[model samples]
Target: MNKVLFFAHLRDAVGEESLEVEAGGKTVAELKAELAGKYDLPRLETVMTAINEEFAANDEVIQDGDVIAFIPPVSGG
Candidate 1:
């Protein structure tokens, strides 16, 4: 299973901070697409994704057992 993390508004939107699923080693875009479909998160387009703490492109493939984090832009004091 692949481990995925979430932060800020993204977590609140989904009402779940994290999730794990058995998926293939597809690109980040593929993963995002699947998740978006499942969660119905229309704002996913505005969110940023990372793998192993490194900002990554949508086409970046996610390896098995990877730690992928979803972080939305945050504005605060």
Candidate 2:
């Protein structure tokens, strides 16, 4: 299972700070689509994903046991 981390508003929306998923062999975007269906995340388009510490495109393939993070841009610096 691959591990996923959610930060800020994403964590609240997903109802967890982190979770595990069988996301290997899938593009980040595909995985997001799956999760959107599973979690009923209708606003998923507003979120950003990261592989390791770098921003990742939806088409970017995720590695087995990769560190994936879901972060939503928060206003107010």
> What are the per-residue Cα lDDT tens digits for candidate 1 across 1-77?
78889888778777897899765589888889888888877688888898888898998888888888987876778
Worst 10 residues of 1 by lDDT: 21-30
Q: Model 2: which residue pairs collide?
A: none
Poorly placed runs, candidate 1 (over 4 Å): none
Best by lDDT: 2
Cα lDDT over the full model 2? 0.85
- Each model's RMSD to truth, in Å? 1.5, 1.4
Q: Give me the runs in candidate 2 sitting further than 4 Å from their true place.
A: none
